[model samples]
Target chain A: LAKTTQPISMDSYEGQEVNITCSHNNIATNDYITWYQQFPSQGPRFIIQGYKTKVTNEVASLFIPADRKSSTLSLPRVSLSDTAVYYCLVGAFHSGGYQKVTFGIGTKLQVIP
Target chain B: SAVISQKPSRDICQRGTSLTIQCQVDSQVTMMFWYRQQPGQSLTLIATANQGSEATYESGFVIDKFPISRPNLTFSTLTVSNMSPEDSSIYLCSATGLAGQETQYFGPGTRLLVL
Candidate 1:
């Protein structure tokens, strides 16, 4: 498993774009970058995932540079509802073998209305 | 994506008591996982439940303390045995779409408070 480092907290205003970046210096070639959003009392929800470059979804976008050591989750036009903890995980996309994805201390995003 | 339902959405239990959280998936899944999330902390994998087999627990978790059962591919349960204040946390269950699928869909989570 690859360890990820991200900011403990971030503040953003409504309608603004929020970008949370995570550093995984030991990311493996077979590893994939994934992001999840968790709100109070609810389970974490998958936001976006990408192996390299940029991948956009209905909820968010993921940006991974060529280095593959870091990935950024970009939430566009944030709202108060988007104020939640965002987690970045690095692991194999295939779970058949003997690999497990572990989540680290996530970035807490507070969207100010 | 699969829909997962966890019973006992939230509960308050006395210390030394035990609670079993149930997870049911709409469709049959290949792998089921249980995780614990302490207050103000991140999620930690507790164990992986495989049908007709024993669960594989994490480093800090034990089968004696957090026993898990997988009766089939669509359902699983996690029991927090001999609960303590330290056992107060949100327990979440997740399931993989396929055998090789890494994308996990999580349940709403069960909040357990041991007093």
Candidate 2:
């Protein structure tokens, strides 16, 4: 099992750029690093997914190093709504086997006004 | 992205009773998953509901307790049988539409508070 470690909690202010990093040292070759944001009383929403380098979407940007040992999710100019638990998961998308996507203890980002 | 919906958005049930939560997807999906999340905790995979076969349960979960039904590609249900206070949690349903694109969209979870 590829285990992931991330900060337990973080604090930020509104309009601040918050970056949450996750370390998955034993990630597999076919695995992709994905992030999800979950708010209170709601299911998690997919934030971003990346294989290497950087992938930017309208919501956030995912940065994966060449070694792939870790990944970062950058939320630009976050607001109060961005206050949620962020999960980092590593999984094989098309490995032809059952991909048991494991989510780590997410980083709880509390964005203040 | 896929739109998903779950029925009985929330319910407070009595002990020893059972609650069946329905998950419906907007389109056909190859894989449907059921997860449980205790308040202030991360999500735990309860089982994987296959379209035509018995659902595959994860560790610490069983068919007799968390019975799941996947009748087709677009719908699945997870029943919490013989419920207890410990079973009170948020039950979320998710589905992956494509094979290689492993984006799993989630429904607005069904919150069950077993008293």
Candidate 3:
């Protein structure tokens, strides 16, 4: 499994866009970048996933660099409820099974009113 | 996406006691996982419950301490044996769909407080 590093914390005002980046210097060839959000007293919720380039969904967007060494999760028009810890994971895809990825210290985003 | 549920949302147990957490999924899943999260910390995977076989535990975790049972595809159990104050933490259950499914869903978690 590839190790990931992210900022310890970030602050953003409501209605502003927040971008959290994660770096995986030794990302594998078959690795896919995924992000998750976790609120207090709740399980982590899947946000967005991407292999390369940009992938957007209704909730968030993921941008990956050409080298696949890093990825960023962008949350648009953040609200107070969006304040949560975000985790970035790099999972290696196997032929017939799922590989577990380790969780690192996530980026805590606080949305201020 | 899979919907996962765990039994005994929270419990306070005395030292040397044991607590078994039950995890149920709304649909059949191919992979089931157990995790521990200490207060103000990130999640650490405890083990993977493999159906019809023994569970695979991660380093620093053992079956004697954290025994897991996955009888089928929809349900599993994890028992924290001989609890102590240091064992107090939130236990979470996670699952993934059939083969090739990348998304993993999680349960609300069972809060265990050992006194």
Candidate 4:
């Protein structure tokens, strides 16, 4: 399992783009960077995932550099409902076996009005 | 993504009591896990519910306290034994390995409040 570090908290205004970065300097060859969003009183929801370069979904986008040591989750047009804690995880998932996922403190993004 | 559901959405139990949480998935999944989230904190994985075998617990968690049962591919149960005030937290169930999807899908958590 790879350890990940992220900013403790960030603030963004409504309708602005929010980019939350996570660092995993020891990321392995098979590791994939994934992001999740958790609102109050709810379970964490998957946002986006990427191994390298960029991967976009209906909800968010993930950007990974060539080194694969870090990844960023970009949420476009933030709203108050998007204010939540975001978690970045690195693991070798869907390998036909059990993969252990570790969750960091996460970046609490507060979408201000 | 799989649609997961948990029983007893919220409960308030007395000290020394026990609470069992049941997790059901709409589709068969290859992996299921139990996690704990204290108030205003991140999630901590308690164990992996392995079908047809005993669950694999993480460090700082024990089967004696957090016993888990995965009888099949789509259903599992977790029991929080001998609860205390400190044991109050949200228990979440998650699953993965559904078809071509690689990310895990989570269920609405069971909120346990030990008094």
Candidate 5:
């Protein structure tokens, strides 16, 4: 699995767009970048994923750079409820299958009212 | 997305006691994983529960301390044995990772507080 790094915390206000960037410098060719959001006392939820370029969903959008060394999760029109820990995951496919995946200490986003 | 449910949402147990958490998925999934999250920490994979075989544990986790059972495709259980203060954390179950899609869905986690 590729190790990921992001800010420990970030602050924003309602009605603003927020972008959290994740760095995976040692990413492999077959790696896919995935993001998960975790709220207090709840499990992590899938946000978005991308192999390269860009991908968008109703909730968020993922932008992967050309080098695939980093990615960013963009949340449009943030709200106080959007405050949570966001995890960047690099999914590696090995032997034509899956491998042990781990989650790192994610970036904590605090949206103020 | 798969709908997942977990039994005993939260519990407070004494040391040396054990707590079992049950995870049920609405759809049959080939890969079920158990994870532990220490307070203010990230998740660590405890094991991968296979439907008809022994669960594959991750490094630093064992079948003795955290026993897992996967009897069918939709249900599984994780038991925290001989609990201590360090065992007080959230236990979560996830599925649908390796079945085909790259996404994984998680149950609402079981919060355990060992006293």
Candidate 6:
């Protein structure tokens, strides 16, 4: 399992774009960067994931540079309801027989209206 | 995607007592995971529940304190033994994706307040 680092907290106004970056300098070659959003009292939900370059979804976009040492999750036009803790995880693209994946202390994004 | 549900959404238990949190998935899953989220802390993986076998626990977690049971592919339970004030936190259950992907869907979580 790869360890990840992220901001402890961040604040963003409504209708603004928020980008949360995660650093995993020791990321493995076959590892993929995945992001999850967790609201209060709820489980973390998959936001976006990508190995490199950019990957966009209905909810968010993931950007990974060539180095793959870090990745960012971009949420567009944020709202108060979007206030949640976002987790960044580094793990193998494919687990051979289900490896134990860990989640780090994610960035608590507070979308202020 | 799978729909996961848990029992006793919130419970207040006395010290030295135990509480069993149940996790149920709509569809059969290959693996189910249990996690603990301490106050103002990140999530920690407790163990991986495999049907018909013992669960593999993490470094700090053990089967004695946090016993797990995977009766089948769609159901599992985690029991918090000898509850204490430190045990007051949210317990979540999740299921891994069908393929080897790291995607996991989580349950509503069981909030345990040890008094």
List per-model TM-scores for chain B: 0.95, 0.96, 0.96, 0.97, 0.95, 0.93
Docking class of 2: medium
Q: Which scores higher on TM-score, 4 or 6?
A: 4
Per-prediction DockQ scores? 0.57, 0.56, 0.67, 0.67, 0.58, 0.62
Clashing pairs in 6: none
Q: How accurate is candidate 3 locally (lDDT)?
A: 0.91
In candidate 4, stretches whose alpha carbon ends up further than 4 angstroms from where it belongs are: none
Q: What C-alpha lDDT do the candidate models reach, one value each?
A: 0.91, 0.91, 0.91, 0.92, 0.90, 0.88
- How many clashing pairs does model 1 include? 0
lDDT of 5 at A45: 93
Candidate 4 residue-wise lDDT, A32-99, digit = tens: 88899999989999888889999998899899999999998999999999999999999886455545
What is the Cα-based lDDT of residue B57 in candidate 5?
A: 93
Candidate 6 Cα misplacement greater than 4 A, ranges: A93-99, B98-102
Interface RMSD of each: 2.4, 2.4, 1.5, 1.6, 2.4, 2.3
Cα lDDT tens digits, model 2, A11-104, are 9999999999999999999888889999998889988988999999999999999999999999999999899999999988644234568777
Cα error, candidate 2, residue B59 (Å) = 0.8
Docking class of 3: medium
Worst 10 residues of 2 chain B by lDDT: B96-105
User: What is the C-alpha lDDT profile of model 6 across A46-93, one tens digit per residue?
Assistant: 888788999999999999999999998999999999999999998874
Q: Could you tell me how far off, in angstroms, the CA of residue A54 lies in candidate 5 after the best superposition? A: 0.7
- Where does model 4 sit among the CAPRI classes? medium
Candidate 3 similarity to native, TM-score: 0.97
The residue-by-residue lDDT of candidate 3 on A6-107, one tens digit each, is: 999999999999999999999999888989899999888888888999999999999998999999999999999999999999887554256578889899
> In order, what fnat does every candidate score?
0.55, 0.48, 0.55, 0.59, 0.55, 0.64
TM for every model, in the order presented, reads 0.95, 0.95, 0.97, 0.96, 0.95, 0.94
